[model samples]
Target: MFGPDKCRSTDKVHFILQHKNPKTGKFVDHHLKFAPSVPYDKLSHVYTAILKPGNELQILVDGEEKRKANFLSADYFEPAFIPPKTIPDPDDKKAEDWDERDKISDSDAVKPDDWDEDAPMEIEDAEACEAAPGCGEWKRPMKRNPEYKGKWHSPLIDNPNYKGIWKTQEIDNPDYFELDKPDFEPITAIGIEIWTMQDGILFDNILIASDEKMFAASASSDVLSDCQKKVFDVLYKVADIPFLEAYKNQIIGVIEKAEKQPILTIGVLVSIVVVVATAILRLLFGRKKPQVSCNVGETDAPGNSEENEKNDASAPHPRRSRRET
Candidate 1:
């Protein structure tokens, strides 16, 4: 499945290999049937195929191997389809008179008087009935049929003749033969055959290796990171003009407001600073407001004049009354 309609194979990937069987003189298809479906999108993707010693082949997506199999075993045998271990014995057959169903409907059952087989399931509200005052109250109550027997079926039981999973004996494929080890051949290059509607698709980081460690080291290199950074830098520069303009307008608005009320702006800033400082002081040193203790008869505590001066300094200053000119 490639596209939304799946009518085209442009996005579809099918890994195929055509091998001429020397014994049979016919070309054999030793291909992977369940290749991972490629997604058609703007995001980049990586598909990799690794052929290692011992005829092991691995398919990777985005540097992670998703499928693996032994090509030797797969090509020489039917890897996709497996013979059933147990099959129903053809010699054992159900008799013509045998009834598999255990239950049947009771022929003597009769319909109840209140069944109301012809009654309507829902009726109009009595208030909405124009001709009759209580006309719409006549509705049939939906209920289960009294004489209905739920779907009849035979109860399951262990079979004496199960003869658990019968498997066909493995036989040598007369036409199958092994290719020379060197004939497997080293992969000198990788190729992509794409019939796409769009062009300019850049495929990068093509790696071919029999050793897993070598492939891992190459795939994990910083080349991709550097390329991604370069691409995103250009993209951000192209897309940032509107955002920068909007931010500039916001800063200008703030400056204009500050110009209109310089004193108010200063007061608000000072108040914010004071609040933040007070919170920090409380958090860091556990400072708290001092509770003033004054006796009922005493106007002021002894040696408290300096404390009163400090309180006066901390409180907001009252504006002095102006003298007449």
Candidate 2:
């Protein structure tokens, strides 16, 4: 069973490993929390958890181990390390009048004269004077009552009738079997089952091996690259075969229809041939001729040049004359 989904701190990714208890026919969960959190908004690097045979587990993030745990004793696991059948006096009843306080009130204390017994603790000081309007009388402040014995209680003492905490009696677990050597139980399948809040999660390179070395070799870059190539080939070629075949059939149908009407087919074929021939001719000799500049190596017309020179010589430039003067 999965642990709590939401309602927990968002800072951690919780992983729960559950095993069936043969004796109780109930599932026991082992939970692990890892942090420096999961990046859900973007592509997060792969995280790996390695659990070895000897109750040793390591959490790795991006190929580096973050935390390691060694379970030398069953105390690290719950239900396996059961509490004793009896425990120190959890049920020991305390006497109703038992008192644990070390201090007592002093009976000789007296109230001072300034203690106005009738005055209220809070009087209106709104007038901004030493005395407020309609609140001249100050109430006496409360103090520890001298006559109070502070709820008399008897000191704590050992209980003569203290019966200890009751625990589950130990018996042989029907499901537990002894193993000859330290080895992991055989895993028949490996799968991923997750509850995600958003979509578009991409899972790749699921690897399983006997140990870290095998996993490292199998999940190498070269291996993953080959796997990706295979996947791409299958998707583009194998998966698209039906659609491609249908496309080819459609073209064939069009050709067959055209063949039924020879005149129309011939006309279309002639048009296509013309278009193809024109395209080929254009490709072979498409270079545009270098344009001749209208004024290239050419002098101005005699009439315009003479007229311009006459105009320039005849025109009186007042600014030029002033500079010359």
Candidate 3:
């Protein structure tokens, strides 16, 4: 079984080996838990565990070795089936006068003569009224009192009676047994028991084979490499913009190049400034025509009167003229 160390924890991964103890006839567990070297969320990752012939264990993530140790070593794995070789002595007991304290209060401490325990922590400012004249009834602000002294306490000193920690002697256990190769059980069934708050956990391409070469062949697929290539291509496209392609490698590279050729750097900066200033000038003042205004009561000119008489001689009158009668 493989899972996390606890519920809702995605930071660690654990591999458990369950088998029936030959001596005790009860089922036991051996756990190997560690933090993953690569991210295990929002992306597919390959997890592999290999048990070698010499009781050695190896854990890998994305075909990279992360943790390796001996399965029987007490430093790496938790062997719950094995009993301790020596147990604490039941007959041993601590002495009555055993002092475990490291420090005690000093007995020679005394209070100073000028220390005032009853003094207030703050006092009203006496010169506030004189500083600001005609300010109505100005309630003076309070300042920290210089004469106030906090409660006194004696300093601590090392205790001479300390005898250090007490411990009991060990004895050999009667039920202790040793196993050189604990991986002797036959493969029958496999199961997984897990508790996690995360959703949409996927398990794919699970391979259980006796030969290590078969497992290696399955793990060497192009899934992870293809994903990494796609991410790099996206970043390349985003950096391929005008005036940025020259420094697409990194911003630090641009600074180093600018330091080497200061003349070129100044020319590029002046060009950018000129382009921006021209755009601003066109936006503020462009494509506008002058407007003309005329007075409503202005008199007509002499050319306008002759044109009006010619127009009246060619028009028909509304009333009959007296010359026709």
The numbered model that scores best in TM-score is 3
Pick out the ten consecutive residues of candidate 1 with the lowest summed lDDT. 1-10
**Model 3 C-alpha lDDT per residue in residues 110-205, reported as the tens digit of each score:** 878888889999999876665666657667889999998887777889988988887887888765778777745776776666555776454556
Clashes of 1: 4
Model 3 lDDT at residue 269: 45
Q: Comparing candidate 1 with candidate 3, which one achieves the higher TM-score?
A: 3
- For candidate 1, what is the lDDT? 0.49
Better of 2 and 3 by lDDT: 3
| lDDT at position 114, candidate 3 | 86
- Each prediction's TM-score versus the true structure: 0.38, 0.40, 0.51
* Candidate 2's TM-score: 0.40
Query: lDDT tens digits, residues 261-314, model 2?
Result: 222444544444454455556667966774323323546666699875666568
Could you tell me the C-alpha RMSD of candidate 2 in Å? 20.6
- Backbone steric clashes in candidate 3, count: 0
Which residue pairs in candidate 2 have backbone atoms (N, alpha carbon, C) closer than 3 angstroms, thus clashing? Answer: 119-138, 119-139, 120-139
- Global Cα RMSD, each model: 22.9, 20.6, 20.1
